[model samples]
Target: MSIHPYIEQAIELLKAMISIPSFSRQEGDVAAMFEDFLKSTGINYYQRKGNNIWIRSKNFSDQLPVVLLNSHIDTVRPSSNWSKDPFSPYEEDGKIFGLGSNDAGASVVALLTVFRLLEEMQQPFNLIYSATAEEEISGDEGVASILEEIGPIDLGIVGEPTQMQMAVAEKGLMVIDGIVKGVSGHAARKEGVNAIYKALPIIEWFKNYRFPLVSDLLGPVKMTVTGIEAGTQHNVIPDECRFMVDVRVNEHYQNKELFHLISQNVNCELKARSFRLNSSFIPTDHPLVKRGETLGLRKFGSPTTSDQARMPFTTIKIGPGDSARSHTADEFICVQEIIEGVNTYYNLLKDLYIYPV
Candidate 1:
């Protein structure tokens, strides 16, 4: 089958974006490129004090609810094992292969295509296109700036790769640190209480810790120890040891409940065991899901966490490409999937705002 003209336009745009390596905080160049695209299309937009760029639709009116289309411009660092040049976009078979092909770049292109189509049709809706930065580590710096300035909106669509599925819910993320303290002593004496040894109980507790199997669109909560550091050297008993824990939580469990549960299970002899919890976001069964389904898009929940967990709007993770290909050596997105995503998003906007009953 021949490709649609809009899809072709999107393909060219995606290639242009993939050529620029917008890795995390280094999104200045790509953001500028997006700004140029907006200006060329004659869309009204402005850059925030930070690197984020916001594009507003000319159809903004009092009757329509403002819709925000959000996607990050940054991609994770490219691995050395990539068979093709990471920054150089390439098309093989039916897929577009590049560094950010699957993670989020596909969604970025889809948004661009959808907006262009909307502008062409003179669609009636208050739309905002946001290209954010620093989403890999935390979205606080980038997204917070937008929220602080623009305030809240009616709804938000986060363009993360959901394999053409509408992700109505996602698990929250919490980063915790465990510190164990013990007495230091020489290896020859071997009389001091080893902090490393004290950490054993904590490890055991973590191993046996039974996370509640709560059923939701996203599934059960999970906990994992991401990093551990204890001993100083072979000849000394280190007095301090620290480990990091990553937890993906469901809506049923709040941070306070989980923290109290963990503290209760931990023994008191490990000195200080503290945790730092971040804010959580939950997705609602908004009208957007029905709109997406009407456009022939699949509906599902996200297994992994995204920046949507930090936003307070009725957030949904939906976009082109597959999550399995994300953060992999040969990351790629089918060209057709990108095209379908653009049409789907266009239809969603039409149903929700342009042609709403």
Candidate 2:
């Protein structure tokens, strides 16, 4: 059992990254540091777009299929409830604590370490390692901006805090803004349609209606009415009602199709924010999934979205740390977790063979 020799350096790199505040859409400083680290490792030909940084294997061959190893480099702005400075990295027991340490810094540095090792050797498929920005806010400047340069990818491994388990299916996010129209009138007159009253049934429909297609791995499509604005005052029957829906779609349907179904059922005028991040699922028979099964990793569908949402390819999400610890006041990832992440990632890719996608 050969262990990753540079695990120590990987941990140090994560610590260094945590010390810098790489908040979403504001990762210029940390991106520069990441590039510096790559240069130090003799990897100087990395492609940079926006704040995302990506590099391919030195012996990258166009003939082979490409496997993209991706993780985000951005953290959310620290909430007002922290016991320690969020930007400061510290260690306690076997855990490293700081912002972004668990959510993705651990995975980013682990993948970079594995990339260094893989570049020194050779794999069945070409490798592209990327540390992307703006995952926290799901901004356009992140992984989405780099795909054109990295070219086609057959498969992607999104590194997130999944406790080393495999997320074969991930829920996609779609926000819908809705408006219900009615005629305004004085409350005493009782002669006008109340928009707020009109919206109740539509909101109830979102809560009760179920999509026909249900994914076995991801289960049902979930939608919630997260926000609403209706009445102008107590005396007047408001003519317009606006609401926001947070939809968690399964891979069984596209966002646009789901929107059409909902709009047909509800009386409100509906508009989907964007259909780009529709739900994603990799087949259980996919070689990547089958490969992880050999290592006895448990498979489950993730309700949360990650950088995987941006990759329109066959992808799996797996990494160290616990998803529960991400964005907490005292965020931490075990040092041992990073060590195992490197080993597991290396084992998964060391001999991976790509078939037609």
Candidate 3:
């Protein structure tokens, strides 16, 4: 089948974005490019704060519900393992290769095209498309920074690499720094209570303990002891052990609740870094999910974190490309994936009905 003009336009825009290095906290160059593109398309009322750019449809109204379609504009720094020039865009076989191409460039442009396609038409809801920065780092200047200015969003679609499958739920991430204190003494004489020894059970608890409830969609909350440090010298018994904990929280519990539960269970002192990215889930019976089901899209719990974690309102994640390819060497998205992504986003939103909050 022949490609639509909007799809062609999105493809060319994505290629231009791939050629620029828009790393987290440093997306000025590419954000400028995106601004120029948006202006060229005759979009009049977009807003830019830091590197985040967003625009509402012409028919925006507070009475109607809003559907937010968001994708990140930033890419992770190119890995050392890259065989091709990460800044140079190239097409091979059926794929377009470069940094950020698959992880989100395809989704960014495709969703923007979908917005353009629908902006002039009447619908039951309002539409907003955002290409934000710092998503790879989950920085404050990303989507989390602009939620208030856009007005209240009834629901959201976070565009990550999910191969066009729907992520009805996504895990939230929390990191905790902990310390285990013990008596210190000479190591050779065995005169001290070793802090590292005391830390073993804590690590085991993280590995073996399971939460009380399991989500049918998201399964169990997961925790891992990722790093540990104890001794400063070879012959000295360290008085304190420091460790890092990585938690993947499900929708069943808030991050603060899990942190409190973990603290009560362990002997060590644990402090959560932050609890901003709470787990996100939208019911399978939601109108958007029901429409997606009719279109034969598969729905599953996403183990990977996305900007969906940052949104406070109801949300689902679905987009082009594969999450496995994100942050890998020589990242690329199939040309066909962009074509299908635009069509899929358009079809999913064009006729779907939503109840306003």
- How much lDDT does candidate 2 score? 0.89
- Please give the lDDT score at residue 332 for candidate 3: 95
lDDT of each: 0.74, 0.89, 0.91
Per-residue lDDT of candidate 2, residues 1-357 (tens digit): 444557877887888999998999899999999888878877899989889999988899988999899999999988888898878888999889999999999999888888888888877789999999999988899999989889999999999999999999999999999999999999999679998999998999999998888888888999999999988889999999999999999989888888888888987699988988878889999887888899988899999999888888899999999999998998999998998898888888887887853
C-alpha lDDT (0 to 100) for residue 57 of candidate 3: 91
Write model 1 residue lDDT over 1-357, tens digit each, in one string.
887776786687788888999888888888878777766656545655467877666666667667778888888998889988988889989988888888888898788677666755544457777778878766556765687566547777889888777877677777678888988889789578898888887877776677765645656667777788988889898888788777767766766677777778886332223222233333344567766666676766566767776676667788898888888897888988997788778778763652353
TM-score of 3: 0.97
> What would the per-residue lDDT of candidate 3 be over residues 1-357, giving only the tens digit for each residue?
788887888888999999998999999999999989888878857999999999989888878889999999999998899999988889989899999999899999989989999986888899999999999999999999999998899889989989999999998899999999988899889698999999999989999999997888889999988999889898888889999989999999889999999889998888999998889999999999989999999999998888988899999999999999999999999999998898899889996788744
Q: Which stretches of candidate 3 lie over 4 Å from their true place?
A: none
Model 3, position 319, has a per-residue lDDT of: 92
TM-score of 1: 0.86
Off by over 4 Å in 2: 1-5
Q: In angstroms, what RMSD does candidate 3 have relative to the true structure?
A: 1.4
Once fitted onto the true fold, the runs of candidate 1 whose alpha carbons sit more than 4 angstroms away are 1-5, 119-125, 186-190, 211-213, 233-238, 268-284, 293-297, 353-357
| Least accurate 10 contiguous residues by lDDT in model 3 | 348-357
Clashes of each: 0, 0, 0
